[model samples]
Target chain A: MVKTYVFGHKSPDSDSITSSLVMTNLEKELGNTEVQAYRLGNINKETEFILNYLDIDAPELLENIEDDANVILVDHNSPSESVENLENANILKVVDHHKLALKTSYPLFLRFEPVGCTETILCKLYEENNVEITKEMATLMLSAIISDTLLLKSPTTTEDDKKAVTKLSKIAEIDVEEYGLKMLKAGTDLSSFSIEEILALDAKQIDFKNVKSIVNQVNTASIPDVLEMKDELEEGMNKIIEKENLDLFMLLITDIVNSNSQVIALGKNADLVEKSYDIKLEDNMVLLEGVVSRKKQVVPIMTENA
Target chain B: MVKTYVFGHKSPDSDSITSSLVMTNLEKELGNTEVQAYRLGNINKETEFILNYLDIDAPELLENIEDDANVILVDHNSPSESVENLENANILKVVDHHKLALKTSYPLFLRFEPVGCTETILCKLYEENNVEITKEMATLMLSAIISDTLLLKSPTTTEDDKKAVTKLSKIAEIDVEEYGLKMLKAGTDLSSFSIEEILALDAKQIDFKNVKSIVNQVNTASIPDVLEMKDELEEGMNKIIEKENLDLFMLLITDIVNSNSQVIALGKNADLVEKSYDIKLEDNMVLLEGVVSRKKQVVPIMTENA
Candidate 1:
């Protein structure tokens, strides 16, 4: 039997893990017992809670798709080439929110719908498969829906998220607003780790021919707190830079307080960043006003300038 | 008019440029008059020759799409989220080969099937639209098909590539094999610039809590040549590391001989690299047996063992 491995984007959250788990059970119901779910990235505390509360075995952690497995990727890699690295395995399916890349190989079946969370799509599958939505699966999906949609505040939110909340609340035996608030509260633990750890969690690698470096940002609910962590963030960045001997170093500290990001770029051409952003450095930070969203707001300006 | 900017992947080749240009014309015939084509990466020699032969203006070079334009990413990004970015735009259409991402915002009006090149998909679109395929467009689409499919030797090759080649050869009036060889020759110009200049392309930032350093890599087509360039690569890495005062450093001199890569991971862990790859250090090179494809073979191992 060809075993199937399920995974989500790098640094997966509640929705990815829960949906894959629910979907794996749903797949078994559909007569595919070889599918096993895995996490492409590390799991956070809140997702851990929902999984533990329901007593679901936490999926194994995998760093890259290059590992040996027939993988089903979710969340981050758009089309699949980014995640289709295993040479000998087959990619049976994919479920994600990001745009797809040019394909590596077409799936036996693929379901990609741009919604706030993967769990919403999987919930529908769970319902379709009539795999009696267990309380644990419901809670997992519920927490996932909450974190990804940002309590339905993100621009990416859709009617499906609202629907998922309603359906999941009933199934999981919880109040929607109260659960959402609690999950968000649990997810927003900024002080649990130093600025460096927070930065690495959301870090992305930027490859330019000969030069390659990672850029990381931290989106905070409280910018004042982010400021407080600034010293640690800087210290962490400096240490990593020294350890890795990077060509350039940077961190985008978005003050949840001011709803803006203070960008600090370091390198020989660190000055080039000033030219790239069309902003003058003020007290060691590029003051980007109204830059709250890491992907929509900050990345756009960087791309436009690059 | 909402102008559509078309482009291809960075570190571009023949496929990236031509496909975008041809697609530009195809969109025009489809009555989308505001289609603008651009190159997301540098125009490689192969593409330069193809464009010069067709007497077309090469698209402007773009280093990254991380935040650039509102770029109309073709055959890049996850397919499901392809049009998510097009949320604000009145998306005229999408052409790609990568896997699809989920987008449930509404409905998709125009989408092409996944294939080897964006140009291959464009050919189908042109035929379906019952429009004229210009000589310039034909050359571009053909070159794109040829380059992306690696002259039909790659696993991704399809019958569409052969069909595109036949049609394109009649229009472009050139023997593609000879042209492809010449383009490949031009591509292997090795390096005309210093290793320092080359390393600046994709330099990244690293943070280890309190310390900071920059990391860089120099990718080459040949291993012996990379080794020949060893002095150059090393001097460059050292100068940058020292000038930047980096605490640790490593340079990989990968040999792309017979689809195998030998890495020279120098720095503090340089001593232990031999243990990671099970390679005996032979004169400053950590010889990795049967290791090829830097993106696939090397990075994952390093991230794990490092």
Candidate 2:
């Protein structure tokens, strides 16, 4: 039997891992062919939680497809993104939800909804194919969709995601509202986390003027505790900025409830706030509303200034 | 919402793409969080056929995860194999069927079963979780299972795959044997495909002497077609071997009906045959019987001499 490997991109999270398994299983039900589940990057704790909850293990993480002879790459949906691995044959299939890269193929499944999660696409397939969601898989998919869609609260959320979520909620037999709170509670356990982890919980980076900078916001309800860790975050940010020689750095505090934000800068030029957003600094602090999501808010600001 | 991108490896076929989407949707249902799906590879015509059949567009392929600021890796159940992209948090979660790569968390769900597809695991999750299989999803899952298990005829066909197929068949509203045949017919439409494509369809590389060698095989009902494609495959593989700087090349003809094979070879020692297999080499052909699998049959012979 020919081996078909199912894998996600590097640094895959719950969605990629669970999606690969789900799709692999779905295809298996269809054809009974060989599909190997693989991972590109590390599987975080949240992903593990869902996997363990679902009673499925994670796939072996492959760093690059360059080494694999025959790769059925998941997560990333482009040939270019596959690191051009398996140059032996052209890419056979691609299923993803990000903007299509500059280089792509025709007759592809190229879904681009500007939604946050690739898993939404998987949900639609499950619904359309009429595959019953196992309670565990339902839980897993539910977490992935919510995590990617930000509980359908992200600007990237679309009608499709909304529809997918609605259908998935029914099949999984989950209260979408309560499930959101549970996942958030599970995700926001930051009391004992280090500053590095806190920033990296959902971190991001930007490159401007040939200088690279990184900013991340940890989602948490315990604002005072996060604020207490602010000093450590500043210190860590300072060191990282110096070593990397970044022009600016800041951690935006986003309140999910109020959608309000407070920016904490760690750069020498604190007055350069005008470069990123339309706001003024009061005592080197910037307050903004409806700025809870880092991807929706921070990335745009960074790109605009960049 | 820190934009979380959930994706599978590149060139994801129907399995990877569908699973990622389904799992993401489940997550959203369970946690009401945000998630995105991505693929690293391009979409193939076969998968496109299935997706288009359901009136669903393919997903957007993701760019390479190289040098990605953060990696949410999955599949491979180890941080060690995570491609060194993000400087920090190298490992997030490990989800895989292969053995855990070196160091991983202890509380991981490591599934090391020698199964044909990861969808089997997903099927189990659905069963255990009591998630009802939808007709559409059951069809897709059935296709995937059939693809992985080779219509429940291949040696890799596990009892688990059979059980999943049986259960899914009921939900899919189809007869198992009939549906299996139809799905296979749909999957292996080799009429318009080239020998190069047939060779690349489910080909894998074997490395020996610090040099990589590729093995391609095609299983057909008749030997004539295999013989017809022999020259094309040889020529194509020869160029691939030279350009890729591989050590050796070989392709096998597995006549499923005859339960035999006509193994073909390339490279400097193309005429040589392994003595142990009782290969009756009439010219360059290594004739045999009950040898329908390349991985189990031809690969052993090719690597025996290496």
Top-TM-score candidate index: 1
Off by over 4 Å in 1: A52-55, A63-68, A78-88, A102-108, A124-133, A190-196, A207-213, A242-250, A253-264, A267-278, A286-290, B1-306
lDDT of each: 0.60, 0.58
TM-score of chain B, candidates 1 onward in order: 0.65, 0.74
- Rate residue B203 of model 2 by lDDT: 55
Q: Every model's DockQ, to 2 decimals?
A: 0.06, 0.02
TM-score of each model, paired residue for residue: 0.48, 0.46
Candidate 2 per-residue C-alpha lDDT over A1-306 given as tens digits, one digit per residue, 9 for 90 to 100: 666677665446666777777767766766847776777655666676566656777787665544434444445543333444544433434445542332311111222234556667667556656777676666767788887666887666678778877777887888987867666656666665677666655444544334466666655556665677767787888887888787777777765555567787667644455567867776456776667766566654555565
Over B1-306, each residue of candidate 1 has an lDDT whose tens digit, in order, gives 656677654445565667677777776786878877777555655666677776777887644333223345565444322323444543333556654332422222224344566777677667756788877778778777766555655445668767878887888787888876555455445556556655553343332223343444333456676677777776776777678776445554433224344555444455445655777777567655554333234433444454
* Local accuracy of candidate 1 as per-residue lDDT tens digits, A104-183: 42322345555777788778666644578877778878888877666666555789888988898898998877766666
CAPRI-style grade of the A/B interface in model 1:
incorrect
lDDT of 2 by residue, B166-273 (tens): 887788787776655554455545677775666666455555334366666555666776676666777887888788786666667666445676777666645334
Best by DockQ: 1
